[model samples]
Target: MSTTSGAAGAAYDVAIVGTGGIAAIHARDLAELGERARIVTAVDTDAGRLDDFSRRWSVPRTYAALESMLEFERPDVVVLCTPPGLHTGQALTCLEHGVTVLCEKPPALSLAEMDTIIGAERADAGDGRFATVFQHRFGSGAESLRRLVGDPRLGPPMTAVCHTLWYRPDDYFAAPWRGVWGVEGGGPTMGHGIHQMDLLLSVLGPWRDVSAVAARRARPTDTEDFSAALVTFDSGVVATVVNSLLSPRETSYLRFDFAHATVELEHLYGYDDASWRVSAAPEHEDTVAAAWAEGPKGRGSGHAAQYTALFDALDAGAPPPVTTADARDTMELVAAIYASSFTGQTVRRGDLGPGSPFYDRMNGDGAPWAAAKETEVPA
Candidate 1:
């Protein structure tokens, strides 16, 4: 474990692991940050990809192994764009060395793994912090809606809709680890829909319980291609969530129905102020419109928005946004959806922990379809 000069009086040094497509976004956003952060090194086992990434991003250094990069150049923060299966271990390593970690979505394959990562941060008690990428929560539209959650003008939230319907062809899962339960964790529920689910949880404080169903509809993979759940928040706000990778027309939509207004957001991946709409009850139309108009605006949701907030938190010596504890809430929801679906029972927020099967793996009892697929005789 080595240490680089702190970012006390300079830009935070950042090292990006895994030069995949997502890493490009991280590099571009950090570049846009100008002086807040700097990409000092790039790491990847693929030599060709590493070279290309370094050249494209103008990153000064590159390494084929993560340990070597951490040993020689200890960046203040390591942005992990690696696979889900590797997130827990990689994040643990960074925290052990007192370097903050900004990991991509599905930060871990299971709640157990996520807990380990969170534990590492607490045990370190140093400058290291762990933050997951849940960019949807930082968008201006989401910010505005969050502010009005209990605002008397909007009243109490009623029912909600959260859908992540997208398409991924067979070739899209050509990568060996793409749809595997042990690697990618679960299909759309864990990978694709998590962004919107995280955003939903951000708006609705704490969820109470969930009843769900999952199926391997069309995708030829080891995990379910689609899932749906009915979740109830502590505030008595019930929501229907549907996540699918089989839809032909892709859409990521969320609707929150409050007593006085119905607020909705429609977008594919990211959203801005323009993606939101509010419809008010007759008596509160003007009030709702004025409140919506006065809320936060302009900032679009993406890596940049979250990164900007993260840098500000680091500068102020505060825990970064989307901290492990905060992410745990969203992750627990993912686990509950799976547990409820597989067990044909309602799963409450505190139902899963160390003793729960779903805590260690999403397909805790083995997805029924996957079991059947394995037993099918040669046709």
Candidate 2:
């Protein structure tokens, strides 16, 4: 509603398609940036939300559908804040119209859905760029770690661990699509665990194999609210992922162990940022055991912090930290976890590796997660 005009570049003008909780974060960044960008148009399937959006931001353009927004507003960038299942279709639509997209994480449900969009992007030169927000890489702790990744002191990360705990009220799942099998896909893993998982991969590199388990143990939804996964990177690093909405308390953490040192990000915000610790190894067993003290909690909810970095990156014209291809890697891990849980098997990273048939799975009707999902959520 209240935005300055005059965007000059191909990626300058922006539109936000969803007006939910997460969308507000993106909107705030664009709004504060003033003339740096414009929230050209707002859109939602329900339509009533647009009035609130208009009043809040003084936004002038609103549309009920994404295509109509694109047709009328002609923005250069579109930030997708829709639900997880809608990511692929909406992203592909924006790309077709020469709009760069920065969708939220777990970009697609299965390797198959991911493939449809990734394939089209690879083939179309000017369809526009795509990225997902894996903003942990931009966090203060991560920024420090990336700078030293290749240094002799922190060289060759050997392992990583991620833990995320948050409170999710029952009403949070009142939205019909919040915890469905076909729609939301998985629970905390896709919705919650993904942020930590993506951070681990960014630090350790691509995964070579993964073993995982997922279940709908705590929530009423069809998808899982809790999950844990083990990832082995091609670079020989091992990592662990744990995400849960069942926790009464909220905490978030990611730690990496390198050849000579350890790096970590820990905070009270479940999906947000916190303080970081980098330290050397202890020489003696007793000394190491004595040093098992509590660490610092994170400072800000990673939401606003991440947006600061994302908007800065976009302004600089440098590509964001996590691109569409990178987002697919995170989803592959999610898929592998679901597959492993369903089939009681270890999923090879190569099975969904580059050029694998899994990426091209259009309908994704036969996914292992699907088979495992056949059993209804317990009453």
Candidate 3:
């Protein structure tokens, strides 16, 4: 794992791992990157899927296994779009081989898994070669909001509401890992709501504690179909979080209340500048508008925006966006939400470790479904 610049310029040889729905997003985004990057190869266990991906993306090579891809092509980065359970192992292998990784959301199934991934990264110090696909962080809306949050013109962030309420039918969980705690981790809180929470954490900083409750009201799955939490950030800002897969009218919404303005984002999956609005106090109205006008504009929240930034960091020999440290913080928050919910107590940050039950598994010692009232899905 060395950060050797590829080609005479900054062009990188990229590889895609796991040709699934999310992988398609990465492949398409990488294709539009033009000369800045190239999809040298793609990997998947299914030959037919791999072949289709290779043909669709015009990737020069395809492999059924990661080992073969590393041994033969050995591209600059491996985009891990595999199952959540395989993330840590796959990421460790890539880092060990000196290959950078851009993994999808819920970076690791548990904090212990995250620690293992971080250890591998540390062993390859200067490499700093791991990044997660928290693409929401790169959009123009997030960029603008991050700027406003820092600027005193908006004042300190005081409170927020981060909600990811969407529907997922039982057939959607036929993929095996979708609803299980061992593989997919938690339900909506881990998979769906993580995006909004990541965006919220990006603005509010570290959370001090979380008090939450999880339930299985509609989905017939091993994991809780829904979870809600009250999170207190270290910055003194408190927020409410609701993660559910039973909402008929779906939305991924976040509202940040600052001293001078209220900034909100309402979108299902990805967001654009239009999806965000800022309501400023009378005295700070003009100032907030002016500050927001400073452009990081037009870019939509998707893999392209994030991938471009990741490639640029690699090009400049800098640590990429959504580093392991950052991912760990988000994962810890997820752990806290589960721990608090399952135990009926507020989970404080820094309390979870090897000694804590939630440290090794998101479900902790007890089963989430057992504690919550389970609802049977119709056949």
Candidate 4:
């Protein structure tokens, strides 16, 4: 998978496996790099996706599996674009061969599974970094929101909520792997909500406790169509999160109420779209507006932001945009919610931290460590 620059990319720095839905984004972003980022090889279980990817990206080689591609390509970076369940094993393969990986979210089916890859990364910590796809972090407006959180003058966020209300056609879940617990893992929360959930976790860190309820109210998906949770942060911030593939009209939004101001992240999660609004409370609204006229605030969304960050890191020999440690925290949050909802209790974040029950459980196997609940994702 050696590469020479013709056009579209500066030099070859990485290989991408799994040329599926998200792979297109990686390819397009690399192409747009205009000689900055290149895809050395594209591996896929589907020969057809490889064919399309090769013609589209001007990539030189394609493989049906990671081993062949890793040995053949020996690229500096590998992207795990496969489904969440396949990440743990594939990432380990890439890491063992000295390839850095930018894996998509829910990096492994379980925290235990991710440990295998994380363990390797720890051993090789200074060697190369493993990153997860919590791409929403790159959104243009997100940085502005972060600044807002740190400003005490803006007041503390009293409440925050994330909503992923979107439409999923019957055919969307027609793929057995999608709706099936074994292959896909969890429902809307696990599969779709993970990204926004990461954003939530980023804004409200150290979630102290969580209580959740999940149910498959609509859709044939084996997992829940809808799930809701109430979380308490170690910072004393409270959050309510709800996600679903069951809604008719699509709506994706995040909002927070601070003592002096209110910030609402609207349309931040719908595919190919987003918007946000931030204002001071009525009493402080005027003063905030006066300060706001000083400048504009916001960030990027989706593959556009993520792909650029991922490639730039690979090019400079820097760490990927979102680290594996970031992913672990997000997954632990999900695990806590699942545990709380499934066990009929509230889950504390410390329970999933180092030396906790879930810390060493994964041992990095891609195979399912725990069976999916015939009902909801496990706690």
Candidate 5:
């Protein structure tokens, strides 16, 4: 069961828990780490996926259950790419066994679940920890903009726009869990748009309040197909968020208007340095141009950049990027958006807790609208 190589001392033992399509991404990124990390095993309930992943990644061991994998392989790190409903439990299993976890986005279905994962992670005193895959934060362009946030030249971020508008056909929701509240949590807002929103939260920091609306206008799914929100950041930045699955022309875009310059990132899925553009105000044009040019370059927003940084953290015995606290901030935004939309109220950072329905379910009290609303998309 244990596939510890002789080079175990030179590399961290890495195992993947879910052998889905996304698992391939994790494998590819981990493989790029070379000897710094080794793919010790892969786990999946599906025999076909397990075998395919192992053969494709050259992983030496495979398991059908997480407990068996943990007992046998004892990987130093585990990647949880399972569904949103399963993320919390699977991640808890790994952390309880003192294994670090790199969980995919929407790390938990609800705030309660996030609290449970954070508890387990805290109890585990070792270097083994939890980090979320908010890969957009690692982009060179994003890093540049983040750095510029603190500079006086840009002043404070005043207003911003975040949008994730992509088309998902009927076939995309054929899966049983695709649009359910308990399973996938929410529709485009929670699953698809979260990437850009997380990136937004990363650059802007904590959100103070949210007023939003969600509709199941297009998709024939239980969850809302579209959502829009007005967000107020703690730093007094007001922003608008729009997440949709009905757009024929797909795009993932974020724009931050600071006092002295406007920064924008335009891309469909992932972005490189070239995806970002800076338009400086005339008064601070020279300073902004020079600062942007001197920022970090070349790193693209993807799993590889994050995984490499994770391994470096493991080597240094430091906490990895996008820690649970950081991920919680993004999750809080998600909860707030839903709470506001369904309840028709402005949701604050503390509004969602054990007492609020949204604290435990994305579609609090069943969305307050009919699933087959008149605006439902026709197949």
Candidate 6:
């Protein structure tokens, strides 16, 4: 296996695959990382896009395929900004090549695929690690919230709310893969809401079970445009999650109602310390206020912050941030949401495995609306 190790203070080589919108973000963040990382190579099927990205980002090398990049560049890490369907295979390839991968969200379409990637990472030992981009968890606001969750002053988590109510017009789905089940996976729940839900899981720990409902609603898509669920965490914290792609006024919000305080975060896509607010209970107001004030600060949730943490882990020879194991629970929650929505049954943490249909695909028994849409004759 190739080694990720280098002399201390040496910048890790990073090759970004897929020079799309999100890949640009990864490139920008790597540029911001300065000496910690260097974007030595770029890979994309679109030659025009590849050349443009390489020139714009000042990347020294380019390739038409990941295999060619891995064979030649063999960078320490590869940032995968490819489609959901491509993540599993690309990640596995990176692992085989002994290159760490920091993949975009909805890392895989199903729990089974994520498990396979995790298994591959395990086999690689210290050679390569897989981390997912759940940027919300790296922000100081989230850091403070996590610390407070365990502090005696915050008390226990009682209930919570997580919403990813964003709009996507008809034109947004013009891309052939935008709303497809096989390629993009499970619509808003899997793609959009998974971010907030991941942050929720990051703070609350493992979830116990979930009961959900989903519908295609007002979009031309194979998957649900919206979904809602009632999730119960292992700590008995109950939370309501809503993911929608039809809301006119877009918003990403989360509220944690603890015994001592009601912690809330109001933001659109990303959040910082200013996006959060704390309302301490009357009795514990002074202590809770003081504790919250003294917690971590400054860092905001975004690709740059997450990359910073990731580099730190790589530098220390530890597992990268949002390790496949760390992200497995969130991915499981996503699968549970889809499973519960489709099967009309509460799906628990351990309920999905090799035999379960949801284990392999988000649309377990096929979305109920898919058949209806199929039966309808073209107008």
What does candidate 2's lDDT look like per residue over 1-379, in tens digits?
Answer: 1233335322256788888877877777666555656677888887677778767887788889999887777776788889888988998998887677888776777777777877877766674778786666565556545556666644578888888887787898999998876787767877787787777777666788878776667667777777777878888877888888998878877888876677677775333232665567764333322332322224243544554555566656765546767887788877777666655678887576546433443113344444566865877
> Clashes in model 5: which pairs?
none
For model 2, the superposed segments whose C-alpha errors exceed 4 Å read 1-11, 125-127, 268-274, 282-321, 353-379
Q: Give the TM-score of each candidate.
A: 0.96, 0.82, 0.94, 0.86, 0.94, 0.96
**TM-score of candidate 3 to 2 decimals:** 0.94
Candidate 1 per-residue lDDT, tens place, 1-379, comes to: 2233334324688899999999999888877777677888999999999999999988999999888898998787899999999999899888988899999999999999999998899999678999999999998888899898889999989999999999999999999899999999999999999999999999998999999999997888999999999999999999999999999999999999999999999999888888998999999999999999988889999898998888778767899899998899999999999999999999999899988899989999799887787899996
**Model 5, which residues run further than 4 Å from truth?**
1-10, 370-379
lDDT for each of the candidates?
Answer: 0.91, 0.70, 0.87, 0.72, 0.87, 0.89
Worst 10 residues of 1 by lDDT: 1-10
Per-residue C-alpha lDDT of model 3 across residues 1-379, encoded as one tens digit per residue: 2344444347778888899888888888876777768888889999998898888888888888898888887687888999998888888889988888999988899999999988899898446388999999999989888877768888888899999989988788889888888999889999989998998999888899999999888777889899999999998899999999999899999999989999899999898889998899999999888888885899999998998888778767888999999999999999999999988999999989999989999999867566433555557
- What C-alpha lDDT does candidate 2 achieve relative to the native structure? 0.70
Q: lDDT: which candidate is best?
A: 1
Better of 1 and 4 by lDDT: 1
Q: Provide the lDDT at 55 for model 5.
A: 93
Q: Where's the lowest-lDDT run of ten residues in candidate 6?
A: 1-10
- Cα lDDT, model 1, residue 67: 85
The predicted structure with the larger lDDT, 2 or 5, is: 5
Model 6 lDDT tens row, 158-199: 999999999999999998888998999889999999999999
Candidate closer to the true structure by lDDT (higher is better), 1 or 6? 1
True-vs-predicted CA distance for residue 137, candidate 4, Å: 0.5
